[model samples]
Target: MLSGFSSHWHYLWLVAASLIAGVMNAMAGGGSFLSFPAMLSMGILPVQANATNTVALWPGQLTSLAALKSDLRKDLLPVAALASILGGLTGAEVLLRTRQVTFLHLIPWLLLMGAVIFGISGPVSRWLRARSAEPHAKRTPRYFPLFCALFPVCFYIGYFGAGGGFLIMTVLALFGVDEMHALNAMKIVTACLSNLVAIITFIVRGAVLWHYCLISMVFAALGGYIGARYARRMNPDVLRRIVVLTGCVISAYFFWRQY
Candidate 1:
């Protein structure tokens, strides 16, 4: 009843939607706002959709971490990586154990929360920048305290990552990471590690729907490459606003669909 088989059309839609999501993430953040739902619409169950989405978008985070490697706070990397792995594995396990219907019910709330956090990130960054303007002592990062703070954020990233990167940056700033590059570098590292562990968990548990995940991953990479070229020329603030708005609107739509 269509131009091609239903399966082919669905794959086409997933590819196109993932391309746009990648562009959004490269320009700003919040690609999951599109990619997760695209997986769902393809009839993947909620938990699997989430797992597949996480796996699909993970390489970009790795790419970022690679580029920022020189700025990584070496003093903080061990604890951060440990926390990310522990929390990410726990979150992925919980997601896998969750009943399908319950996860579907929680989707809107998760999306809304991610959007709200993202909306506040810009203001929080400005505050960090202003505070960094002052001369302050180089406080040694409290490893335990920093890990405690980051565990939940990385767990959330593993569960449903949209705005978790910003949360990591904010937490790092709060814990005396004064250099912007260091903060960015650490954020990417933790996020990448979080996803890496989750990806492993998903594969071990057979949660990722690879048929869709593969297409999403390839197209998203292409989109990221293309978007990165134009990102420097665009106003980041404007793009951030657009990403936040898109997340909010999509969350609202999901909420309506649920209730």
Candidate 2:
């Protein structure tokens, strides 16, 4: 148990972390990169921290989704939603079955992969735009193939979810959904669904730290609002770079500690 001062400091730290996470999530897609470490630093166990992080960041995701509701409705695809929900359920089940040691071992690789994906997002986006502009270029393949591709991405989101939004945006872009706002909207919806299933599983299994989750959620939502309001002034490329750097540093630190 924490002493009074320690407890106060922990909460303060969490509030600051969640607020940054919300801004990062709104600007780019790496909120988990902040919130997860914050919890771990507070002596929360890995599994509990993951569960609590999901719950804490969930409300901010919902807020983003609400803001993007119009765009989502305009370009929403049923198959994508179905794939995300199904994959998320499967991934959450897998996470529940995982041992703490195993999850600790996996964290570095997951973070590395998320970082690589985020780092390449800009180039990938540019390439997609170029391809889309070409004459007689194919926009998207068939629904089955797209569904298959999105399933694993959603599964990852359910399991760890650090940079899942970048992956989702890439997939959507490949599917010929080139509008930035639409892509972001779809990313938020898919992420929200993935977290929804995982949070339910965490709740059922008694894994979530509800008090911390509640505190982070409120602050994260506030951050999301602030980020959205100031989005025009923020550079997404800079934010993406920061997220990539943070992911690499965190991954390296965890790797060293665990190994």
TM-score of each: 0.96, 0.88
Looking at model 2, residue 103 earns an lDDT score of 89
lDDT of each: 0.89, 0.81
lDDT of 1: 0.89
Tens digits of per-residue lDDT, candidate 2, 1-259, equal: 4597897888788899999888887777787877888887778888788889988888777766777788873435686788788888888888878998888789889888888988998888777667556554334447787788899988988888877877888887766776666677788888788889888888998999888888788888888878878877988888879989999999999999988
Q: Say what the RMSD of model 2 is.
A: 2.6
**TM-score computed on alpha carbons, candidate 1:** 0.96
- After superposing candidate 2, which stretches have Cα over 4 Å from the reference? 1-7, 73-76, 129-141
Residues 1-259, model 1: lDDT tens digits: 5745887778778988899988988888888998898899898999999999999999887777788999988889899999999989988988999999999999999999989998999899888887777777767688898989999998988888778999999988888888777788988999999999999999999998888899999999999998888999999889889888988999999999989
Tell me how far the alpha carbon of residue 212 in candidate 2 is from the true structure, in angstroms, after superposition: 1.0
Candidate 1, superposed: residue stretches over 4 Å from native:
2-9
